[model samples]
Target chain A: MPMHSPTDTPLFGSWPRAYAVVLGALLLEIAFFYGLMHWFA
Target chain B: MSSLDWWILGGTIALLVLYGLYKSRGKQSFDDYTLAGQSLPWYHVGMSVMATQASAITFLSAPGQGFSDGMRFVQFYFGLPLAMVVLSITFVPIFHRLRVYTAYEFLENRFDGRVRSLTAGLFLLQRALSTGVSIYAPSIILSTILGWNIYWTNLIMGGIVLFYSVSGGTKAISYTHLTQMLIVTVAMFIAGFLTVHKLPTDMGFTDALRVAGKAGRLNLIDTTFDVKSRYNLWSGLIGGFFLQLSYFGTDQSQVGRYLTGETIKQSRIGLLMNGLLKVPMQFLILLVGVLVFVFYQFHESPVFFNKQEVERLNAGPLAGEFQVLNRQHQGLSAQRRAAVLNLQRATAQNNDAAAAAAGDQLDKADEALAKTHAAVSDLVKRNNPAADKNDVNYVFLRFILDYLPHGLIGLLIAMIFISSMGSIAAAYSSLASTTVVDIYRRVWPGSTHNEVVVSRWSTIGWGIFCVVVAQFTNRIGSSLIETVNILGSLFYGVILGIFCVAFYVRSIGGRATFWAAVVAEAVVFVCYYFDLMAFLWFNVVGCLLVVALAWLFTTLQLNLRPVRVADE
Candidate 1:
């Protein structure tokens, strides 16, 4: 099988963007969890 | 356990073992035995990776954590996705391209044999000891529920996994994991549903959440920047990142999972899938614990969850004192239950003032209840000083046996055992492969031994060693999950530091890197011994210290060495 280098490919048009998407999702999770804690606490 | 429950538990485990062995049939070569012939798809690799990580302790203890500490523990995994991304980018391609048997093999090529041996030795020590705890965890719970001796349970549990792992190698472990994960996911979801279903008739899931929240059980996030805190946001992201990086990147148990992938892309995607799914999965598991907490608020819970210890207290000289404590606990439990019901009703009626007042009552009741529970812990400690006073591990197990119906109880128990099997098998296989490929092979470079045979014997040997270690795990005096992580943190940082130097710092030579790792490891141990900071920071400290010290040593060695003349 051919190797797909992490830098060469893009899940969202670019590698950096793919990384950003992951980080962005993590931030969203934190925000949502914080909100849940706030709403419930 | 009833006859029907026994049938379910025994049949489920039997089916798993036969299926694993059947799927892994016709594996003769060392390559096929160790790596499943690199034929598994991304999903197999992904499931295997997840199974190897989500051990029985995770399923059993995490909900207990949620029950006691709330959702702040979820932050401990916040750095996982980031670590996954980093591993997929750097570690995946390199490992796959090299087709190495163990992660430490790559270390050898990048550095030298001693570095590989040192890192592999660290992995062997940590994984074997941690696997022992993994075996002991399910055994303890099963023993408690079934009234069996823990020693016999440990032997039986460890022996069963060892049989299959020795028979089919990594193929069996991976195939079993795929099935194991599917069943675990379903069983846990059912457990969660049943926790809610058993709540008070008028209390919906939302009401349960409100009760739990008011009791401070919904602490999902704490954005505070306290260095001494273990699971706050910043510590989780930074310290957790380093921990997970070292765990998935260097730990042969984890690396062995991804290494079974057919291609680099397969491995990368498998790791990415883990990253995407892990946090939510952990959240749901913890949420189940919170729900269980809510369930208990409307009902009665044990004053001390460890029934065995409670039984000991009942039979001992402290029986009267224990009875007094138990009566006090009963009083507090009743008050807390009443307060929670009031809070639930007020929230349902949208009476904000009433809800606030009830919340205060609930807090007071809970505080008193905690005091009674602390007294119970003290009673246990005074009765038997060698006993593990923390009952967090028993919380969920006791709930399952006490409340859940027969068939589901069996399935949940099966799930715990199967999860334990997955991780323990992976640890055995990884330890065996590392020993055979890195240490054994290098120490006797030209021995005409059958690699496959050596690998099989090594698996059996390590399995025995781990099972022996399991016997001593009862004395660790902490939650099994935390103990495992604490143990890993001690070594993972130094290992990661070695890899970081190997991959990123080109100028750092083998000797310098090696000594830097040794010095940094000592510092980590000293820091942990003196309670310098939370365990997670050890990862960050170990990695950075190694890199900095290695660079310093390398630069100093170069500068101090005399230069040779060009003419010569």
Candidate 2:
């Protein structure tokens, strides 16, 4: 087995934070689009 | 086509091809040819990943979907961001650490060669078939615009892409993709702006959007939970997630794109970029269609978008009936235009009762217009029994040709062709890479000396096979985008299932997974044949079936052949 680094920073502070931001953005988008749909309709 | 239009289209494609080849020029190595030496920057990887996923059909047919069916289709991509996060966290680091050429190579590492070969075989089959659809999409543009035989256009389209793909390999494909995506985004944005610009002068963008919304073309989200409904929030999150996960993780076409990143971080960022952007990109494309739908309200829209079918109907015995239907369609269009204007004014004035009346009138006019359209479709079918009744695919293209200025028309057409080439090149690159790395290299382990040559030949061979498959694309009716996705849903699930077990269920051995995949695939086919549910669910069902069956099979195998306690 080869040693690999685990502490590399992504967009956010850490990998888990980055994943959370992505999921958070998705939730925000869904909520926004859902509101936009009813607003326009 | 005008001489200027021809010049614009030809110049753009030639420039892209030459530039890609120039940028890709380097010393040959097997790994470099297949994976771009694993040195592409995140931006290049991200753009390449987007280009590989957004084929010409996405540009051509997605707007038509929006125009006819509304923006509910955008929900289909809602799962993509979640899938990207999953892929970034799980798939990227593992594939990077393993230093595998193909995603299937990891299957062998985790299980054995049989599992590897089976997964690779499935990827090849599905990718080859879908690549054929991608090839056929641009061929439709050429055949429709130039009045040429689809067969010749298919060959020309495939052959051109193959030349660049073979010459520059993955690096060339990625380089061209950067330019392709830039052009696609700018051109599509222009198309949307022009669509609203061409609407009635009294109506601005918001008014047009309101008009589309009132007509049900702005259905961006649906909270309903119906298994049979293909595009809603629930199905999109669950079904679309599985589909995107399988597509990005297991399908070599997409895996090859992200795999070219210089490091695991680059790959993860590239995928995350795609996740963040794909939904908005699809939303804007479909929004263009909605705007087009509104544009037609203020203009004399055609009863049928496919001019070839209309021309055939005109030349046939039903020409008289067609003339009568044409007059009825014109009357309905005029009435609908008036009703739309009335509704617009009523809504603007906040006259709820009057607006309701106008809305009712507009709906009736639309129903009448749809009836006339249906009659034309029937006439088309009567003229040629095999003719596709769904003209949704031609909706946007017809608008561009008939209404847009000559140079912009050519640019938009070129944009479609460029997008198509980017995806087809990537598909060919991945197919050839898998063939050489997984199949050929495995069969003849000592032939690594000539690996580059073999991969190049594999590219040519698969290109030919895909072109041949393109010939049958016409018979598959309805929206070209939906048809391609449906074809994917049938196979993607089982492939994803096998990988899910490989990644998560550590105890499921190779034999169990192989047989589980085989059985799950058969059940999916049966379900599809029987119309068990909407196509998107097939992805979820197929994946879950495989995982469950793998566990069952593993437990059974364990019980049947008990582990012998050696020296106890």
C-alpha lDDT score of every prediction, in listed order: 0.88, 0.88
Best by TM-score: 2
The C-alpha stretches of model 2 lying farther than 4 A from their native spots are: A1-7, B558-568
Model 1 segments more than 4 A misplaced: A1-18, B558-568
Per-candidate chain B TM: 0.97, 0.97
Kindly list the per-residue Cα lDDT of model 1 for residues B1-568, writing each as its tens digit: 6888889999888888888788767747988888988888889998999999999999888998998888789999999999998998888888888789899998778777778889999999999999999999999877897788778889988999999888877888888899888989999899999999998788788778888899999988888898789889988899999999999999999999999998776777788888888998999999999998998887888999999999999999999999998999888899998898788778878999999999999999988988888889989999998677889898999899899999988889988988888899899899999999998999999989999889889998999999999988888877888999999999999999999988887666677888888999999999999999999999999999999988888788844221221111
Which pairs of residues clash in candidate 2, taking residues 3 or more apart in a chain or in different chains?
none
lDDT by residue for model 2 over B279-339, one digit each (tens)?
Answer: 9899999999999899899889988998888888899999999999999999989998998
Global local distance difference test of model 2: 0.88
Docking quality category of candidate 1 according to DockQ thresholds:
acceptable
Q: Give per-model TM-scores.
A: 0.96, 0.96
What DockQ do the predictions score, one after another? 0.45, 0.54
